[model samples]
Target: MIQLKSLQRVNPRDVEAPKKFYVQAVGAGKTDLDRLAYLISNQSTVRKPDCYAVLEALLHNMMDELREGRIIELGNIGNFQIGVSSDAVDTEEEVTSNLVRKAKISFRPAKALRDLLQTVNYKKVS
Candidate 1:
């Protein structure tokens, strides 16, 4: 289930237009690694400690692989790859690592994740 809140927002393309109410998602809370491990443990024979260890190892390995310029794909979860924003240069020789302004990990959700959203139920809140 998801929670939604209504807010008045101006149209960026037409600032002179009157603000209108639009629904946006609001945080319902959060689930951490501990809670996830506990839930996974309950659903299978694996213990919570073991689950936590596996999750931690997954994080470490994923980071190592991503730093090596490899895309990390977790089955139905999604794929993560490093993306960058660089300063434009006039000459090809001027383009170098120094030109990179920022690097960020981008995630592309898998079909399974996108399908899950179709089944979501929402409740409007003030």
Candidate 2:
């Protein structure tokens, strides 16, 4: 089950304004890749080792493609791409690799994944 937690965060700028109450995810209740392969092996003819190897290869290839400035799309899964944030430059000539403050991998969830999220049952952590 999806687990949630409530937390109070103090506002450093205005202590008199009172702390804000926020709800966050405590756990998604996930299984690791090896465990996932084992579970898949139980339902299919493929052995766990084969399933794990395939998963590892898929990851390696996906990373390689992403590094080559290509968006990786897993059908009915999501699209993954690289994103960057940079410091503001006064002119185009001032823009350079050094200006890049951070790089991030972004994922745009597919419609099917969004639908799955809607169906999950959540309970607050006690």
Candidate 3:
């Protein structure tokens, strides 16, 4: 289940518009690799340590591949790719690597994950 919180936000399109309450999903906390490993181990035959090691290795490899300009696709989960935010140059000749503001990893969820969203249950919280 997901917990949602109501927040008041101003509409950027109309500065004079009244602020409205919107529902935003509030995170419960975080689940670290150790917790994930334990959970996975409980659902399968793999040991927790093995699961942790594999997950750790996966993190390292995913970084390396993303740096190499390759997308890392986890069959049913999602695919991750590197993206950049840059300032626009006035001319083609003015464009340079320095214009890039930052690099970020983007994730695109698979169909299975998208379908899972349809079955999610939520509760509103103060």
Best candidate according to TM-score: 3
Off by over 4 Å in 3: none
Worst 10 residues of 3 by lDDT: 60-69
The alpha-carbon lDDT assigned to residue 100 of candidate 2 equals 88
lDDT by residue for model 2 (6-114), tens: 9999888898897898888886666988998899899999999999998889899999999998999999999999999999989999889999899999999999998
lDDT of 1 by residue, 1-115 (tens): 7999999999999999999999999998899889989999999999999999999899999999999999999999999999999999999989999999999999999999999
lDDT, candidate 3, at 77: 94
Better of 2 and 3 by lDDT: 3
Can you list the residue pairs that collide in candidate 3? none
Winner of 1 and 2 under lDDT = 1
Per-model TM-score versus the true fold: 0.91, 0.89, 0.93
- List RMSD in Å for every model shown: 1.4, 1.7, 1.2
lDDT (C-alpha, whole model) for all candidates: 0.95, 0.91, 0.96
lDDT of 2 at 67: 94
Residue-wise C-alpha lDDT for candidate 3, range 4-112, written one tens digit per residue: 9999999999979999989999999999999999999999999999999999999999989998999999999999999999999789999999999999899999999
